[model samples]
Target: MKTAIKICGISTLEALDAAIEARADFIGLVFFPPSPRHVDGHAASALAMRAADRIGRVGLFVDADDALIAEGIKAGRLEALQLHGEETPARVAQVKERFQLPVWKAVSVATSEDVTRAESYRDAADLILFDAKTPKDAALPGGMGLSFDWSLLDGWKGRPGWGLAGGLRVDNVAEAIVRTAAPLVDTSSGVESAPGVKDAGLISQFCRVARAA
Candidate 1:
């Protein structure tokens, strides 16, 4: 099967189109206010409607409250939620059980030891995204455009599907795939022109590379 593609942090029409044209399997709309990629709930809902089943509508959030998560779900007919904050395993289970939507947990990886926790998440999450660990003082947890040691995933063979994210781009994505053999990959900052600004050309290039790989 072909590797799935997820283009995240979509905040514009052109960016949305680029992901669609690039044949992305999913498009992510961030709802966390601290992140530069944050989008209004209503806007995200509108965009997801426009997308209209062309791809999975992903709602990205931090350690948001139940009200916030509910709002996000109602905002868009989201197929999945990416918990990008410091959500515990119990919290993950609660969100999954409450929403009955498949949950994708984003785990920060800055070293090899981080890989071991992947399985614990696998039990609660339907999918696990390996992202770079952000600075402790960072305002937000993710979308930092950082890259961790991909070698940590060098021989990672675990249960549940996984995605490679953080600093993924047109140039390095193929190399990432070769190294991790990730069945799916997600990108946010990598395809952007600036903070919260997605570039269509980069989106197209990224999808092409992921598909080709």
Candidate 2:
């Protein structure tokens, strides 16, 4: 199958358009307040409207409450919910039931054990996003241009609903795909000119590379 691409942390219409032009399979709108890429309901609503059905909209939340998730879903018209926090398997199942949308649980990987932990969410999560684990003092959980050892997933045979994230750039995305055999590759800071500032040219290049890989 062709590798799918997700351009995440899109907070502006320009970035959203760039992802659409790049033919990204999914575009993430962050709801986390602490992140530089954070987007409010009004902003997400406009972006979602502009997106229409051109691309899948995924909402990124960090241990958010139902009220916030509901607002984001309505505003962003999200097709999927990416939980990038310490949410457990039960919590993952709960969120899926309450929202009736595909729920993605992001597992921060640093070692083989971290990758193994994702199995617990197989029954609950619609997708398991394997992201690089951040520092204890880091302000954000992801979109920090950090990556874990790709070899850790060399022969992964667990749940098939999984994707790779973190530290992916246009220069290395092809290699990442070849190395991990990731069905879907997600990026946020990789195509950005600065924190939360996406560059249209870079977005196009990254998608092209992933497709060709």
Candidate 3:
């Protein structure tokens, strides 16, 4: 099967076009204000309209309230939500029930115990995303270009629909997929020229390599 690719943190029309043109299965829009890739509701709406149905629109949030999610859904016409916060399983269920959209809960993994925590969200989340753990006192939750050991997923058997994230780039993504057999992969800083600045060539290369892998 073809591995799905998600180019996260797309804020500009140029970046959006790159993801769509690259044949990315999912395009991520950050809703968290603290994130460098964050896009307001107005900008998101325009980007969504520009994308139309060519790519799957996903809104990334971190412990966002209902009003924020509601606004993002309406404006961006998001088809899925990626929660990368300290939200509980109950919150995931609540958001899924209220929004009626697929919810992907991102679990921070640094060790075997961290991988086990993902099982709790199997029933609540539609999909699970394993991301590298960030420092407790870090400024942002993710997108710091930090990566955990890929071998940590060698025998992963938590949930059915899951993906890999954190420091994935064109170079190591093929190796990552070969090792973990991840059905989906996500990237942000890895494909960026600078923080929050996406490179079209890198986006294209990432998709090509991931697809081949």
Candidate 4:
């Protein structure tokens, strides 16, 4: 199977085009205001409309309220909602039912214990996204562009429907796949010219390399 690639924190038409042109499986939009990549609901919705149907559109949010989720739905043709915050399983169910959309819960993985967290949402979420654990005082929950130990995934067999996220770049994504054997990888900062600024060339390269891998 081909490895899935997600170009996240997308805020511009150019970046969205790059993701679409590269045939990325998922194109993520940051809805949290604190994020440099944050996009207004209208703007996000506009960008989503321009993407090719082959690329999935994802809305990224922390432990946000229903209003935020409501606005997100209005903002785009979202295929999935990525809960990147401390949301409870109940909340996941609520969001899924209310929006009638698939849900992907992002679990922070640092130790073996963190991996077990996915089981909690097994019934509630459509998929799981393993992201790096943020420090206590971290500004935003994700998009820090940091990587955790890939070896931690050496024997992972917990979920077939999860995505590997955190600090992935074109150069290392192939190795990450070889090590973790992850069928899906998500990246934001790693493919950017700067924070929240995606480079079209890198987007193309990442998709090509991951597809070939």
lDDT of 4 by residue, 1-213 (tens): 778889999999988888888989888988899899999977887797787475788999889998888888777778889999999999999999999999999988888778876778888998888888888899988889888887776656756387899888899999988878787899999889888888999999999998888
lDDT for each residue of candidate 2 in 1-213, tens digit (9 for 90 to 100): 798999999999999999999999999999999999999999999999999999999999999999999999999999999999999999999999999999999999999999888888989998999999999999999999999999988657848489999999999999999988898999999999999999999999999999999
Evaluate all candidate structures by whole-model CA lDDT and list the values in order: 0.88, 0.95, 0.94, 0.86
Please give, for residues 1-213, the per-residue lDDT of candidate 3 as tens digits.
Answer: 789999999999999999999999999999999889999989999999999999999999999999999999999999999999999999999999999999999999999888888889989999999999999899898999989998888667847599999999999999999988899999999999999999999999999999998
Q: Which residue pairs in candidate 3 collide? A: none
List residue ranges in candidate 4 displaced over 4 A: 52-54
- TM-score list, all predictions: 0.96, 0.99, 0.98, 0.95
lDDT of 1 by residue, 52-85 (tens): 8788898998889999889988887789999998
Q: Output candidate 2 Cα RMSD.
A: 0.7
TM-score of 3: 0.98
lDDT agreement of model 2 with the native: 0.95
Task: Please give me the total number of clashing residue pairs in predicted model 3.
Answer: 0
lDDT of 1: 0.88
